[model samples]
Target: MLSGAAAQDSAASATGATPVAGTAASALIGVSVDPSAVPDSTAGAESSGSARRELVSATGSATQPGGDAATATAAVVDGSGASAASAGAAVGARHSASTVGGDSVIPPDSHDTVVILLPEMPAMDAPGALEAAAEFFANPTWLPDLAGVRDCWLVTVGGEQVTSGDPVPHQFHGAVTAGFRCLGMESLGVSFRRVDLAAGQADASRAAALVRAVHVKNEPELALRDGAVYAKRLEIDAVQRGPARDADLAHVVIVGGTGTLGVEFCAHYARSGAGRITLLSRSGETAEVTRRLRPIRALGDTPIIVESCDVTDADAVVELAERQEIPATVLVHAGVNYVRAELAEVTPEKFREMAGSKIYGTEHMLHTWPRTPDCRIVLCSSAAATFGGRGQILYATVNRMLDVLARRLRAAGVDAVAVQWGLWDLEGPLHAVGTGPVQAAGVTPMRAADALAVGFTDHADHSGAENRLVAAADWSDVQALMVAIGQGPLLDDVVAAAAESAVVQPDSPGSGHRDGNSPRIAGTPADGHRGTADSAAYPSGPDRVRATVAQGGTKAMTQFRAAAGQPGAAGGNSANLAERVRRQLGRVMGADADALDPSVPLVALGLDSLQALDFRKRVQVELDRDLPVAAILGGASLDDVVRLMAGSQA
Candidate 1:
């Protein structure tokens, strides 16, 4: 967080605004300035003009006024050249003031514009900083005349730092900027640009040119790097390369050592000839912790120490590091407090707790650990950081922060690597939520051993990279999901590989059968079902749909379709079709068919992506018609889906 004076100066420099003698121009342009920072002579200047008086007198106190503050602020500027402090004070004073005559003051010109410049802040401060920024810019009291403001520029600093491998966190900044851009465009009808200025290079001409480029191109994110402005784009490369040899693991320290992944890491390192292993966790030496660590202890005769320490606490980490007689050669920061909830549903407290466990824990561990070029730091991040999963925004953000931290450490000559791992086939958070949604996204859950092996090998040689994504994925399913989400271009190579492999192996598992009935899509079961001899023994019609839905996936669809002579057996009548659809959906969602609301989207009733694919397949098989994957997962209600199915039968 920048000091008030520094923030004002930085904002002014970035916007090419010449600062007044006593009043900062940046404050007028929307960067927050401390009232105390203003000179007494300038602060004492009475706000002049009808616009200023109306704005100040409209609200009697320093509280948010009910209407368009932006228009009112613009009117003040139009009416008189009142200093920023005076304007701010007048606006601040209006919080308690009521309308002078109960008629809202109208600005002389609605075209008046306001430019908001957000100063540089640490990456961890992004969430709170953005919230504060949003409140300031969008607040009714601050901008009662919101219509007057047409453009918003969030001035973010750190383009050079990111390129130079400095630890300046930009992922969170980008995410927050994206959110604000959407909000500004949709809610405020404001054109928003996240302008990144390089450090020590915020000249007026460069800043002006960058802003012009961004405005002209309508780019949401633009960065000034090495005096050249560039638009930020996300791209993915699918490269096939052999893994590097595993690194030596002699003396190791595992944070969050009692957690599932932590224990797995300890066991793997122990097996890999780690001489001494120290486990740090808040749980300390509880019976549960001991039970979890017993197997790892038996893995080898490695000396293991279990200690209670919260990695989030700086003092605890420093004390532990100082107390250790034998310094660790490798530090594995695997700490994470998982919370699964939609972005809107996540409470600030929950976000803090989750972020604290990883972000703060990593900072504390890194800063306190003895720094040596020979030492290795392994940050256990998740695939969510790379490919965001549903209800894991905060999870992804923190993991991304770790990735940045690893790069920063690596740039500082430390052997640090961040491993963005996929879902492990273990009883962890994903399992608790039912891994159907993630599996539907085409990520195959890797066994812990396999995951560790890949991670260790891939990250062993990080001379060219600080982060590596290691996960088992079904490329075909992955490609389908990416295409559905309009990000097919990112995985062009993966799609090509999937197509090439299909041509090479026509009879591959999960591939479409010789019959044209089975269309290859996401969430297909690994094994394709072959027709049974006793076809007549199977159920038919709505009963068949219900049975197949309960059975789950493409295999169920295949078996039921083969049994029901003609797949359209269930399409006898509209009422029968509706009932079958409801029952089938209910079965997949573990809900009661009678209780399910037909007007609600399937996703609202807990139908995840994978289940949606399965449900679509079942419907196609039962009704003998094709169902687009989008109709099921794209928030189409039950009634809408039923109508589509009925129309397809016609």
Candidate 2:
């Protein structure tokens, strides 16, 4: 079925007129099926009904006649049988059909097969263009119909985006294909293909050949260039280290230098003998910033400058760039801002805020910097841009732009690389959103110093690829999460690496299991205790209190009261409830129960949305009381939560 734009383009092209400005000329140029092929008189009706059902099942909505733009095409089958025109008319679509021979018919085996022609995306810089493109490609109206087909081929143009070094406006297509590939693997169990045709190669014969190739091959990624089909594979090139790799560390400009990562970069460069360092951030120098810089300053005679500059403000960035006396030998764009939100909850404004620094900030920095060979531009992108993460659609989209920007810079002979970093073992931006979900997905946080070392060394040695992913991951956990999230093909290399180095290590000290394959919650103790070690090992003070909460029951509560040491409440009273809440909160926040003051608000104790949910669930399960998420995260103290839970129970 042709989209409204596609139909109009096809009509215009057929009449020797110019196609619409923003639409590609597309046509359904296959032979029509014989109406008498179906012996059953009601076969056409059944097929039409099946098509509608399939659409509904795939997208949760069925296309109705004369509906919106998406439903411009519909399935229409006559009483005799389903033909190309009748099929289109049945589903509210327009098509031109031609019959080859009188006996020509759609084979029975090919009934469930489908080929989806994705429309070419226009420039996304225009207002509402990104949203429109995202809606069209990422959540395409045609995607739903693929759910009904046993075999499907998703074809698009512009193989240059993936194959060539030049950057193209194909970010939307990249995201769309990645998402569908995962969807196909996890749920549909259907054959899927993303055929990227070269210029002037968009035709029925070329598409048919690609579809035929897909049937015989099991490759997930295939691109057509120079009239030949090629399979795409992602591989890691071995680093070849050379001398003077650290020469660029003499002078450094670290953007977002007040944040956790910024401080780490500042300290690392200082220790590496950087003669001068300039730190730019939205938050100007504060006492805490001074305190953090003190250690770096003590390392050597390196002059450290901290200035307030929002990188997203183009004027601010330009002003800073112009005022620099000595050009920075190294430029590290570590600035980032984002909130953990599902795609449905990500408004355009929220996306803009999240993407502002990374997109416009990177552009502004790159434009201002002199393109000298000595200068190295290091963009701190995230693994979400590489393999995607849950609740990070906007984050991933913006980071992917960084990856593309790096490539574009390299293509223009600028020394630039985007490092797709994984979770870091630091109290940085991710901490605000809570690290529970990422940890649960099997990503072990890497030490900040070690990750930086590896990223820089790898980039210096292996300068071929403009974008690289540096992460330490448990492949089994990653694979499981990907499967759960309907992700496919993107992690094939990781899967292979996991297979190559699979080992069975002995269980850790507190874990109850001997087998190495069992899934463990991030901060839970071996015996299912939230925040304490085994009671027998540390049989005193807060440990005993924590153990009692872990081993909860009426008898355990009695034991907890006896072991409280200073608590006045007895037998399921507010004091007992407060202790349990404290231990559980400590567990969820990955903090020490004794260190968490009861009077302090949970938010001040670093409680986040994910932690709050986890705390709420634990309360529901252990305390047998329902606690609202708001009551936990709405600036409530331990005593407040205890009172709230006690009241709910009462």
Candidate 3:
């Protein structure tokens, strides 16, 4: 088993420090040296479903090239390491001579470097890749093998594994890069080579040549044919701002086209003069397809076709792409399976389902692309990939893969980009479900037009760049959230630049802050009239009774009235309060406020228990009523709750 000192050494290596046998942290551990990749599309491991296991328990030693085999005993739990059982008794292959004390003996005519492809766990394997990852991290004995090597090339094959922030994946990448560095690999004149097998080009001769030709720079960077590796530093300040470019997207295809954001994209493209836009979704039913197409049809005479298609199905995607009359010049991957739940609530199947549309779907799309050149794929990733919000671990992981995939694609000479968007004002399928939680946190929602402009105009123009993180939020707020979630160090200079540009100009005409030089609409209105007062003008029904309560108004009133028992306005009394409750319920239930029958069970209006709880909390705070949590449980309706409040008052 690895000692605590070894863990400290691994951490120190990440920061370019020498690993001592037993030492407290004497040096700072830097952020991951190389970007990480997302987990592959393997079957859900049993360990992923259970509580996370410590990496130290999985520790085992690996054999060096010249040394006796230590018989590494740990099993692979994540994608970073291999299982000793599956790998057989043999360890790494022997090369040049080296000693445990960090001395080297190399012949005059040798390659001077060793390249190792990071192995992943097969889906059917036991103790899983995650377990293997734990074991690898626990000991990482092979790190000592690089003691005397001139250089080491750690080839990461899948793009998905390159930029992951999830704990297991992050630990695996750290163990490989920093773990090796701490083992005194650098002391032996070893330089690091991160060979990304872009677009599955490993079998191609050109790819092999590219790997052989890589040379490490004097700094902490690597190079391939003079082109620097793509990182946030390279493209962080590269967002193009101005009018939308007339992109030559004669034929554009959108996956997950039946959602609201899909239709919005179709509208934006139609306005941008896309020749023919085809939307693909799994639901082939006529009514569902028609509902999805309604907004697209509203966008004047552009030919918008709706077809039933599943992006996750490789054969179906290939067949559809093959049959397109005009070769698809652009493909937009907007497909996602959104599920927001706590870590403990997530099941292995749910994890797989969440990953299907983004991971498997993007992979299939890339593989099934027509051989025709100039074709580009644009993946719509989310900010969750970066900041990682509560109950969104799986969603964040999936989005992160999009960014990594773009990196791999570009490295492989493909025209691709992944745009990591913040919360958008236009409610897409994922947005519709996730907006509540996002707002509860403090991220400002980006406007629809601005969002489209950022994606199509800003990011699309920068074809050379791989990943673009686009979000309009206060730097302080974002920093606070990141700090709360333990991801502060990941924030780069780009975030600082964005934060500086987004400083609130109270004197500015519009309430929205400027991103760089361009002004973006802030989530809250400029006049500070975001609540019921502003909503009063846009009242939907004849009664005109439901105005949006300004944010925090309800909470303030609840505290005041609950503590002091002060009588409020007549409209705030129980009678009108009941009407307000019914109206809010109607909004949640997707029914007309004036037309809703207060006697009917809210469950009949599509509210489950959790949703009902959400509604109940809103009412309790808004009206300052001392309502029991279960008041809305069982067959309770608006009238039942109103009567209960009245009875409590008497």
Which prediction has the highest lDDT against the true structure? 2
Q: Write the per-residue lDDT of candidate 2 for residues 1-650, one digit (tens) a residue.
A: 01110000000000000111111111100000101111124323111111110111112232322323221111111212222332332233223221221233333332344445554554343123335434543433343333334445555554234322213434454444433443332222345555555444454435334333334233445554433444433222222222234365667888888888889888877766787888999988999999988988998899999989988888888887787778877888888676555544556666566667777677777778543465888788777754555467667666666665664565566777677777777887787878777765445565564355445532332333235565544433344344323233334433442232211112544332323432111132222212212112221333221111110112223323333432432347778778887887888889999998888877777775446655754654466544544444435788887776666445
Give the lDDT of residue 53 in candidate 3: 13
* Model 1: ten consecutive residues of lowest lDDT: 7-16
Off by over 4 Å in 3: 1-238, 241-246, 285-300, 341-347, 369-371, 428-434, 492-650
Q: Write the per-residue lDDT of candidate 1 for residues 97-185, one digit (tens) a residue.
A: 11111133445345333333333445444335334333332332322244544444455555223232233444444344433332331
- Model 3, poorest ten-residue lDDT window? 7-16
| Model 2: residue 259 alpha-carbon error in angstroms | 1.3
Could you tell which candidate, 2 or 3, scores higher by lDDT? 2
Error of 3 at 235 (Å): 8.6
How close is every model to the real structure, measured as TM-score?
0.55, 0.56, 0.47
Candidate that beats the other on TM-score, 1 or 3, i.e. the better one: 1
TM-score of 3: 0.47
Candidate order by TM-score, decreasing, is 2, 1, 3
lDDT of 3 by residue, 260-360 (tens): 67777777777667888888888753686677676667777778888877888888988887887787788888775686644335455555566677767
Local distance difference test, per candidate? Answer: 0.47, 0.48, 0.43
By TM-score, the better pick of 2 and 3 is 2
